[model samples]
Target: MIRALALAVALACPGTALAQAGLDALDRRSELLGWEAVGRLDMPHGTCTATLIAADVVLTAAHCLHGLDADAPVRFRAGLSHGRAVSERQLAGWVMPERYRTDRGALERTESVGLDVALGRLDAPISTTDADPFLVLTDEARGDALSVVSYGRGRLDAPSRQGTCRIRQRFTHEVLGFDCDVTFGSSGAPVFARQGRRMRILSVVSAGDGVRAFGPRVAGRIAPLQAALDRDVPAPASTTGIKRLRVGEGRAGASGARFVRPERSP
Candidate 1:
């Protein structure tokens, strides 16, 4: 249900550009060195940002897999930059939230946003030297310093990171709001909680309105995804075409609007 948004909002934001907001383009080897765990998820239907949380597992947005056939194969390109990747692997299978549906309007619904996550099993494990997976912070603690690294629309070949961002609102009903500079192709991107130089994945990007970015709280979302993966099955034989949406093609519609339940104020 998430779609690409005009860069207008992001451009007019604070009367400056994203680079001025600590959004650094990780185009250099030195810049991308420690963040090889983040990757670009290539699916038959579309592409979304993804993160390597385990040697053989990845986390991404459920909408990225919309209409994906059971037998369709996808790929994960870790630390993709300038048409190169630190590592690449094929998906063996994937598991998403049971409540998620690809119904006509389901993706635009708030429920979809809260459960807009999936975990995919890679065909083979990636070596630590190529990429070291990041740890997930499974708690509802909204840290003041939060950041996001994503291969959004214009930067698909060059992932960028916003080193200084924060949660504008806390998690409510598994949904959290943040002030990150996200765009199309950013779905499944990882939001990280920073502690000095150490970072833990805090959430996965689902969608973003011009006002605020939205994603699952992630604290309680990972376990269910992992459990589903634990009982993983092989891809079934099917004839459905693997449709892949180009970068920034996940928009809900012409307008970038998606439903978000109004969390009551404290």
Candidate 2:
């Protein structure tokens, strides 16, 4: 989502003049149907788009957790459109590939985009009735037609659906080059491909300008991501269940929303 971070790769090759499919702002409930799995990740600094990959797992861009040094929980606003959300939960733990990095110099590398993915283990699983998770299409890359639903900088409150996009080519073996209307806050947004009668997840938006964006090809890469998450699972309960019920839960004003000026996205 950081143009400065992604521009290094976007300028290397001219993108295919793919056909347009208009980015429709989903401000109404009717337009937001079937997109319940897509949610807004509210971090301490900013926000990013995320998708529910499983009952208790969420997939997102690792760069979105730039300021987070540990595997701490973060707030997830599920199915958020306009001012409200269908459900809200905390991401209890996060995991990233060994190759993922947040260093300024490292992020400038070509392979950084491929390693820009992370999985968050939710503290509580979202019920299937509330939102059904999308399956990852790991076996093939032949599908060309693509689409996206995301919360972007301009329409942070409402999600936009770009019903059509094209996979130009693989910028790198691990990165898929896509011509979509991507922007800040679109990071971690799932790029979906129609497989059979269902939509399958192909990649997570890593970086690119609005005209052309890049996502890491997820095939053969998710196993390691899951393995890392498995290793990080806490051994057992080490303390009591005591918790503060009202800490930082006060009536906050609009200033609490700090996702503005999102150039800081890694």
Candidate 3:
């Protein structure tokens, strides 16, 4: 079943072949059991990766939904592989820290890391059997070897796993730097730490500035955010939408990943 799904994905998304070869594909339900909650968010503006930290809540990067109408629609496809998925849900509301600003200049500042995180509330609760939500690791994640599974550009058909990335720097208590391989559409992807048989979410992929990837540490921010989300009601609609520039259409640094698509023969 897993191989069939993988073959289906490979055929549907021919562009992902080269990149997929280097990363492990969570092709079967069994292979995806640990990460079934991690999925892709298809926003009106663009696509960003996301993960379920709670059955009704999703964690992603604030910038992924920045500067759009507050009433836009964002669809979450859980455990998406090829044309199949474990489940799907439409978000009802979302919240980002007040400190996380989306102004063009904000990305350059170190303080921006503190505001990069965001949480979305689902309209309905998802079944645990489809995908189990991950627990947030409250401790600082310095010098730890981590893994990232993301639905990046080109490889959007299925999630790809980079099972052995490392945290190279801890900029502050709130921010950590990693040597993970990420690209456009990878924004909001979870950086995970495997503990025994369980996987815990440590941080979220925020930016890949061509050198290293940066994610907001989950240490102190998660509890409060989770509390706020619990009390917060669903918004009438989502007003924000992401505007994405296609590869080679403009300079790529601002968008996150600078990936080169393979050439095709007619």
Candidate 4:
């Protein structure tokens, strides 16, 4: 499931050193503007990135919650850095595209990429904190550069911010291909485009196949998902059993997390 295109381009670029250097760890909560809203979602199966889009609403990948126990607990650690987090909240509920399926084969389809978005409600609101939720951009990114902040396997202790990355291609109205550097634990990470002093979320990291990481574009999927979340639609029940695997196991590092279809009961 690992792709080498983005890696190869990252390595071949003369600015690779500078780009790597720009991926600074958000160790200090006050160092960046939007770092506080982005956090790590720790699941029983694994970890993935998450961002607060509203005081009580979090945006992440639908697949991140797939296969989890119906009553399994999830922790949202905001602005986590070096074992310290600015805020922590329990997930109350979540909503996803009605068309999303947890089966391994279905999740691998290109169409599934757009449907892989989800919105989670936090048990408590964090509006009082310095962390502010980001606005979703309805317009497509026409800018030359975008930014991403995420936590991955090797960099699990703190969130890292890639100050700038390019959109390699806009595969469709729903699917976006980016050259952003990401890995296991980076799913659900936000891809942002700056507007003046503020930044808007353009997409959430979903998966990477070869050299490009892709996600559901904000305009097409997120808008509808947000509407569903606002209307209190229940998330589709997970039909598959959790496929827990050891860290560094097969395809585990392909994205932020990976799951296999469980055998059915006789």
Query: TM-scores for all candidates?
Result: 0.76, 0.77, 0.76, 0.75
Best by TM-score: 2
Q: Write the per-residue lDDT of candidate 4 for residues 117-230, one digit (tens) a residue.
A: 788877766652445667677665785558888887678899887777888776533677787877778888999886555567888887774456777785566666666765
The 10-residue segment of model 3 with minimum total lDDT is 9-18
Off by over 4 Å in 1: 1-22, 102-108, 234-266
Off by over 4 Å in 4: 1-22, 102-104, 231-266
Query: Each candidate: what lDDT?
Result: 0.69, 0.68, 0.68, 0.68
Model 4, 40: alpha-carbon shift in Å? 0.5
Backbone clashes, each candidate? 11, 0, 14, 4
Highest lDDT among the candidates is held by which one? 1
Q: Write the per-residue lDDT of candidate 3 for residues 28-50, one digit (tens) a residue.
A: 66667667888999998788889
lDDT of 4 at 6: 36
After superposing candidate 3, which stretches have Cα over 4 Å from the reference?
A: 1-22, 101-108, 234-266
State model 4's lDDT: 0.68
Candidate 2: deviation at residue 13, Å?
A: 20
